[model samples]
Target chain A: MTYCLGIQTHQGLVMASDSRTNAGMDQVNVCRKMHLYIHEGERVFIILASGGLSITQSVTTLLRRDFDQGRGLASAPTFYDAARVVGEQIRRVGEMDREALKRDKISFNINVLLGGQIAGEKPHLYLIYPQGNPIQATEDSPYLQIGESKYGRPILDRGVRYRLTTLEEAVKFALISLDSTMRSNVTVGPPIDVVVYQNNDLRVRRYRRFTSKDPDLQRIQFQWEHSLRKAVLELPDVDFDEGAEQVI
Target chain B: MTYCLGIQTHQGLVMASDSRTNAGMDQVNVCRKMHLYIHEGERVFIILASGGLSITQSVTTLLRRDFDQGRGLASAPTFYDAARVVGEQIRRVGEMDREALKRDKISFNINVLLGGQIAGEKPHLYLIYPQGNPIQATEDSPYLQIGESKYGRPILDRGVRYRLTTLEEAVKFALISLDSTMRSNVTVGPPIDVVVYQNNDLRVRRYRRFTSKDPDLQRIQFQWEHSLRKAVLELPDVDFDEGAEQVI
Candidate 1:
């Protein structure tokens, strides 16, 4: 299983993904799920994928090769077109493999988070489904997440306000979300990769990857844990004297 | 859908469950998923259920009707036997319904959390499966949860240490966990039912139910949200000046 998410804050976009993949408990492996395509000042696209490795890998491979022969991510006219380009590749993979794999009862699955900047447009985020359909993140939700999303969703729901959060704060929330996920689930683990792109920067900046032992990751996780326990402890103590009959 | 859990703390055990149940989006309704049977001074058991309402409702109905014909939950000799009784009822329900449901492509599904005290035995918690098997929560984990468990699980992982926490603290954690689940998933909602059982009490005591509009429920949810955001605000800031190349 995989856990990856993208936050489209007003200041910019922040993306995070875990590095664990498995066919079963006995066959576990680490694979980088964050991919970046940069045409420098022209355009940039980040794809964070989760699902069957075969399907995601095939779609990304097709996306990487598109630059030489046809319209590629870097050449797409806008972020929307680039997202569609990704959706189309997912469809291409599903067409080629879904039926053959169905013969063995394996379902073709791939979910992609596509976010980045194009020179003339504001940065945007889209979640592409296994069915090759795409949905853009709106200001109301202000974030897109795929794979193992629920465990981390409440914090995003409560803390991420696109218009009020800064690029740096957005990055912080992304890591915190990932941290909550990793604590509750073993299917997701670090070496987590994060990317922060300021709205008009038009270039990738503030990229960092942390292994489980990384100091910054450790400090952030420890601080968050302490704060969480303190928060729980600080809650008003239950009044057993109320006799538990008080419905209010 | 539902989210119900039992925590075996040093002081006693804490049980909580949301009240929403649905066969489909259009078929949603409010149902009490928590059941209590008391032999008063001899034995007591609380059953929190999730999954097919037909299966769970059937199991509870049989257990409730047992006093007139067979041995009832109040008659179980130990907490362990009470758990087996719940599991056996589940298997009995499966025998009666599984094949008929299969004709309609619906599989028998229900998960139950049983927690209470039986005379001389220490308080205990058990999770019963559709296959009539049961697992006891141990000193190590000290908690059991069913359906929509993940989003609320991290808090239990962090705040609950059975040997270390007071029953009041455990109760606080359970409500906070339910709050997290309700915020992230629409399948689970209030009015939630909670019960606290102290070891060797051998009585059905301390039961409370909270509707969405319940003032105490609102206070807990609001306090949790405020503390959570404050905790996030108190975390150390990220230094983007470290540049994009850090990998550790």
Candidate 2:
């Protein structure tokens, strides 16, 4: 299991992914789910992958092989074209592995959030489904998440917007979403990778990995707990039936 | 779809359920998912159901049939016995419907969160699975949720504790959780039913339905959005590559 999120805002774009992977409770491992393809100032594409690790890794490896041969990412003229190339790569990998996986009773599955800006186009973000089709984020839905998405979706629904005018806020909200998932699910863990891009900026502005003990994260966790408790306590009580015996 | 949550705390228990049912996006309807059985000064048992509506309704009907025929709710010897009776009722319903559901390629699925106090037993909470087996809440895990539970689980993870000492706080947290789900998923909607039980109190302390127009709920929605935006804005920005052109 995994959790990955990507947001495209007026200010720029923010991408975050956790590094935990587990086959079962005792078979956990750490693997980077976020992959980057950069052409210096010309373009930078980030892909946050989730679902079966085998399928995603196969897709990533096939894309890398194409790039290594100068067939796709290195040569695609636009972000949209690059996305198509990535999609085709995923399809190619699926064609090669799906039958074998079916023989083992495993479903061929993978989903990805692909986002970045090219030299001449606006920065865009998309959620690529396991079937290779994709949906781009719009003003009404400025963020896309994959794998273990539900636990973190509510915060994004209430907080994210296309006019997220500040990169700081984007990062914070992304972390808070991750924090919520981490607390509730054992499959998602820390050492989170975050990358921020400023609108029109062709280069990656901020890229960092946050560990569990990071002071800022610790503070956010504590503050969230404290505030939640306070909020719960502040609500007015409802009237109870008079003859009700106290259960506690 | 439905969302129902139940929490057992030192002070008592809190149970809440949404009133939405849908066969698809266009076939949505309102239906209460909570059932309360209270015998003044003697016992009070709340059942919050979720999943396939038919299965849940059938299960509830079977339980009601037994109670009407003198099987134990108001006259239950103990809370454990009451729970067993509920479980037995579920099994009977499953026996009557499981094969037919399977014939239609539908899942024979429904879950219930049962909690409240009986005359001779302590306040207890149980999460009954589709198979009619149930797990009781303990000090380590004091809450159980059935159907569309993921969207609201994060808040509980961050706020609920066995030491949580007040029923009011529990009720508030439960509402907050429900509100989060309602915002993110259209299938879970307004007019939520909530019941708060005080330990040793044989009757319900508070019971009400919350709608989108409710003043208190509106206040919570506003405050939550404000606080969330504020929290996001306070997060530190990620350091990006200096020469990168801003994407916006």
Candidate 3:
């Protein structure tokens, strides 16, 4: 299991993912889920993946080969085209692995988030489904999540706004969202990878990996807990008014 | 879809449920998911259910009939026995309808939370699965949730401590949890039903139904949202330290 999310704010994009993967409880392992394809100032595509490691790795490897050869995402004219390139690669991997997985009764499950900027286009985010189709995040709904998404979603629903949220604030939202998920779910664990892209920077500049004991991460966890508890206490008390219908 | 949870605190038990039911997007309605069986001052069983509406309703109806006849929950010896009574009804309902539902390619999905106290027993909460097995909540994990549960779980994880939380705080936590789910998930909505049972009271004395526009419910929602935003703002800013490993 994994938890990966991408946030597209007015100033830029934030992509984050947990590194833990488990085929089963006994086979837990840590593997990087965030992949970056950067052409310096020309273009950049950050891909975060969740699902069967083999399928996602195969898809990424294929995309990398083409990207290294100056094809695929390396040459795509826009973020949408780059999403299509990733989708096509996913389809290619499906053609190679889906039948065998089906024979074993393993569902063909993969969800990918493609978020980046082409030289001439706006930074964007897309969630590519197992079927190789893509859905882009919009200003009204500026975030996309995959794997163990619900635990962290309420905070995002309350805190993030595409136009008003800054890149820095988006990073905070992403980390807090990831923190909420990690606290509630065991399958998603550290080290966490976070990348922040300033809109139009075209090059990846800010990235951080927070291991399990990272002091900053611990502080965030501790402080968020404190704040939430305090906030919960300050909220209006439950009005167990006598007028509501009584079941018994 | 539904969201019902039972929280056992030091002072008592709090059971809450949302009232939304849907066969699909086009067929959505409000239906009560919380049922009560009270032999006042003796034994009180608050059952919150989620799953196939027909199946749960049937099980509850059967339980109600027997409770009225002084044969089922009314005759059970302890809270565990009461849980078993509920589970037996679930299995009976499965026997009656599972095959027909399976023939139509529908899954026999039902999850129930049986919570309350009998005169001789301590307050207890049990989660009865679709297979009619029951798992009781313990001091270490004082809450059980059914249906669309994840979105509302983090707050419960953070706030509810069986030996420490008061009944009032538990009610606040439960309401906040439900509000979080309602905000993040369309399938779980109001009017919400909440029943608070004081440990020795046996009978449920505090019950409230918060319809969509209920002023108190709206205030809780509004204040909680405000508090959360303020809490997020007060959280320590993310430290995108330059020393952390950079992927690009």
Candidate 4:
């Protein structure tokens, strides 16, 4: 289980993911889910993976191998082309592992949020399905999330708008969404990785990892709870007016 | 597909449920999920049901039949007995229909959140599983929700506390939770039925229905969205300080 999110804003893009991996309750481990590929001033691609740990790891390992052999994504001309190469690599990994996993009653599940920019392309975001197909985020639906997504969706539905948000605001909302997901779901634990890509820069601009003890994360949670309680109080209270006809 | 919740608070209990039922997209219809049986000063029992429509309807209809025949729930000594009867009734329905449904590849799946009070007894709440087993809500976890629950859960995790909340506050939180669930999920829809049982009253004290066209329902959702956006703005913005050290 995991939680990963990607958002495209007017000013840039933001991606966030938790690091916990669990095959079962007794076998929990921490592994980085956010992988970065950067070519300095030329291009950058950030992949946030979720689902089977072994499958995602295999896909990432093969991707790295592709870069090592200079045969795939490294030379793709645009973000769209890079997404295709990533999709192809995911299928390659699935082809190699799916039959073995099926024999064990295990699934070859994997989902990836691939986003970043090429030198001449706009920053783009794509959600690649386990079947190796992908869908790009558009202005109408400017964000995508994978794994344990519902617990955090209400906040995004109410707070985010691609045309209205600045890069900084997107980061704030992404962190808050991740915070809500982490609190409600045990599978998505700490050591959250966040990256911000400034539009037109064609490179990664900011990245940080927050652990359980991070003061800033704690403060965010505290302030959110405090203001939420206060805000709830400001909402109109129910009056219980319907019982006049049948009061006991 | 449905969403229903019951909350226990210091002042009383609040239950809210959406009223959508669908066999498929084209078959969507309005059907209340909240059921009430009030015996004036003697007792009151509320049931919020979710899952397979046929199964829930059968269980509910059978319970009504039992009460009509004076063979169950209505003559039970306490809320616990009534809950047991409800569970027994669910299992009875499954016994009668499970095999016939299995022929069509249909599952005998359902869940129920039951809560209320009997005279001389404290308020009680139970979650009855499809297999007819039941678990009561305790002080440590004072709420129970069935079906499409996750989208609305984070707010409850951050807001509701049974030890301190007034009945009015519980109603507000339940409405907010329902609103969030409805926004994120299409399977759960309006006309919502809400009931409030004030502790020691031994009967329901409030009841109301809100449809999609209901002005009050819209007002609640509008104010919630407004307050939530304002709350997000009040939180401190994320500073992109990590990038100076790791720029690519």
Candidate 5:
């Protein structure tokens, strides 16, 4: 299992992915799930993937092989076209491996969060499904998440707004969301890969890898625990029935 | 879909369940998910269920049928015995319906949280699985949740301590957990049934149903949104390379 999130905010796009992969509780390992495609001055694309590592790695290998053939992401005409190329690559991999995977009782599962900026287009984000189809984030739904998404979705629902205007703040918010899930679930862990893209920028401006010992994240976790206790205590007590005292 | 949580604290136990039921989005309706069985001074048992409504309702009916036949919860030798009774009831229902459900390509999915006090034993909580087997909550693991549980599990993981000594605080914390999930997922909604049982008291003292229009809940929701925004803004900004500014 993995947890990966991508947000397209007014300021730009932010992407974060956890590094843990597990077949079962005893069979867990670290594998970086974020793939970076950059053409320094012309374009930059970050794909955060989750699900069957075999399928995603095969898709990545296929994409890299195409790039080696000189039909890379940098040469694509638009972000949409690049996304289409990525989808085609996924399809190719599926065609080659899906049957064997099914025979082994394994799923042809891989979901990707693709976010990037090209020279002439605005920064955009998309959630690519296992079927190779994709959904772009809209103003009403500015975020996309895959794999162990439920634990972190509530924060995005209540806390994320279209008005958030800074990429730095968006990054912090994304970390907090991930922090909540990390605390609860053992399946998701650090080191986490984070990339921040600003509007109209054709490259990733800020990228960081977060480990469990990161001081900033420690502080955030501490503060969240404290604030939650304080918040719960502040709520008014429910009125009790007349004989309620008898139970205590 | 539904969301229900049970927390065992120093003061007693807190149990809450949502009222939503749906075959699909268009077929959604409200159905009470919390069942209370009290024999006044002898025993007090609360069962919060989620999953197939028909299955859960059938289990409830079976329990009541047993009670009517004089094998009631109050007559159970222990709280553990009561849980076994509940599990047996679920098994009976599953036996009756599993084949039909399978024929229609439907799952026999059902999960329940059972918690309360019996006359002679300490308060206890158990999470009953679809297979009818159950696991009791321990001091190290003081809570159990079912149905749409992932979204709300983080708070209990991060903030719930055995030192939490009051039902008021416990219920408030549980509500906050539910609020987070309800905001993120449309499948879970109000009115929510909340029940609190005090330690050594063989009766439920406080039970309330909350709706979206509840003023106190609205205030807490507003405050949570406010605090999360403030928390995000307080994080330090990520420093980036000079050339990176052009891309973001």
Candidate 6:
């Protein structure tokens, strides 16, 4: 399992992923899930994946090789085309591995978040399903998440506004979302990978890998915990009216 | 299709549930998911349910009838036995409906959280599965949740302490959790039902059904939203150092 999310705010995009993967309780490992393709000054693509590790690795590896040859993401005219290129690779991998995985009772499962900007287009985010279909995020829903998403989703649902949240704030929100997930689930953990791309920058400018002992991560976690408890304390206390009807 | 949870603290227990049920996008209704059985001064049980509406309704209906006749929860000697009684009823319902549900491809799914005290025993909480097996919440993990649970769980993971959280705080946590879930999921909505029972009280007391228009519920929602936004604002900003290695 992994936790990967992308926030598309007015100022730019914030993409993040945890570095933990597990086949079972005893088979946990730290594996980076974020892949970047940069044709600097023209286009930048970030792919965060979750699912069967081998399948995702195969897809990314194929994309990387083609991208290096300037035939995949590098040559694609738009983010949508790049997404299709990714979907094609996913389907290609499915054709190769799906049958073998099914024989062992393993589903051909994988989910990918593709976020980037082409020189002429606005920054965008899309969620590519295991079936090789893609759906883009819109102003109405400015964020996309994959893998162990729910525990961290309430915060994103509440905090992210397409036109209101700045790139910095979105980065903060993304980290906090990942933190919440890590606290509630063991399979998603650090060192965390984050990329913040400012609109029109055409480059991955801000990136960080936060290990468990990073001081900044520690500060954010401690501060958020304190604020939440304080927030909970500040709420009005429950008052059970005397002789109230017990409806339940 | 529902959200329900139980928190057991040293001071007592807090149980809560949202009241929305939907068979499809167009078939939505408000149905209470929380039920209580009380033999004043002797024992009490609060059951919060989630899953197939017909299946849960059948299980609760059976429990209510048997309790009124003093044959089930009413006659149990301990909370564990009470949990067993509930599980037996769940199993009975499964026996009656499982095959038909399978024929129609609808799962015989029902999950229940039972929380209360039986005379001489400390307050306890149990989660009964579709298979009629039950697992009790322990001192280390004092809260149990079912149905649309993940969105509301991080707060509980951070705020609930078995010995430290008072019943008042537990009730507040339960409400906030439900409010978070309601915001993220349409299938979990209001008229929310909540019950708070103090240890050894042996009575059905302190219950409220919060309609969407309920002022207290509104106030809590507004306050929590405000606090969360404020908390996010207070977090330290991200500084993207130039020349940072791009790990992604």
For every model in order, the fraction of real contacts preserved is: 0.53, 0.54, 0.61, 0.65, 0.52, 0.68
Best by lDDT: 6
**Model 4 Cα lDDT, one tens digit per residue, B1-248:** 99999999877898889999999899999888888776789878888899888889998888877777866878999788888888899889988999999999988889999988989989988999998889998888889999999999998898889899888788888888998999999999998888888999986668888778877777778888888888787778765554424421
Model 2 per-residue lDDT tens digits across residues A26-58: 989988888877776787788889988888888
User: Compared with the real two-chain complex, what DockQ does model 2 have?
Assistant: 0.46
Chain A: TM-score in each model? 0.95, 0.92, 0.97, 0.96, 0.93, 0.98
Write down the RMSD of candidate 6 (Cα, Å): 1.3
Q: Tell me which of candidates 5 and 6 scores higher on DockQ.
A: 6
A17-134 in candidate 3: lDDT tens per residue?
Answer: 9999999999999999999998878998899999999999999989999999999998888788898898899898999999999999998889999998888788889999999999
| CA-lDDT, candidates in order | 0.84, 0.81, 0.90, 0.86, 0.82, 0.91
* Residue B237 local lDDT, model 4: 73
Query: Please, what are the lDDT tens digits per residue for candidate 1 over residues B159-247?
Result: 78978888888888899899889888998989888888888887756888878997877887788888887777777877653444443
Each model's Cα RMSD: 2.2, 3.4, 1.5, 1.9, 2.9, 1.3
Q: Each prediction's TM-score against the native? A: 0.95, 0.94, 0.98, 0.97, 0.94, 0.98
The CAPRI-style docking tier of model 4 reads medium
> What is candidate 3's lDDT per residue for B1-248, written digit by digit as tens?
89999999889899999999999989999999999888778988899999999999999999999999999999999888888888899999999999999999999999999998889788899999999999999999999999999999999998889888888888889999999999999999999999988889977678999998998888878888888777777767776755224673
lDDT of 4 at A47: 93
> TM-score of predicted model 3?
0.98
Second chain only: TM-score per model? 0.95, 0.92, 0.97, 0.95, 0.94, 0.97
TM-score between candidate 5 and the true structure: 0.94
Write the number of the candidate with greater lDDT, choosing between 1 and 5: 1
Q: Is the docking of candidate 1 incorrect, acceptable, medium or high quality?
A: medium
Task: Give candidate 6 regions above 4 Å deviation.
Answer: A244-248
CAPRI grade, predicted model 2? acceptable
Off by over 4 Å in 4: A244-248, B242-248
Candidate 5 residue lDDT tens string, B32-126: 88887777788888888888989999998778777767685657898888888888888889899999999999999899899998877889999
Write candidate 4's Cα lDDT for A1-248 as tens digits.
89999999888889999989997899999999999877778777899999898899898888877866766768888788888888998899889999999999998899999998888778899999888888999988989999999998999998889899877778778888999999999999988889988888866668888888988888878998988878777787655555725311
Residue-level lDDT of model 1, residues A1-248, one tens digit each, is 89999999888899899999998988888898998877667787889999999999998888988854556785788888888889889988888998999999998878999998899888889999988889999999899999999888878887889789787778778888898898888989888988888787866777888789988888988988888888888787664433333422
lDDT of 6 by residue, A1-248 (tens): 89999999888889999999898999999999999988889999989999999999999999999988989888998889989999999999999999999999999999999999999999989999998999999999999999999999999988899999988889889999999999999999999998998999998878888999999999999999999988999999877865426564
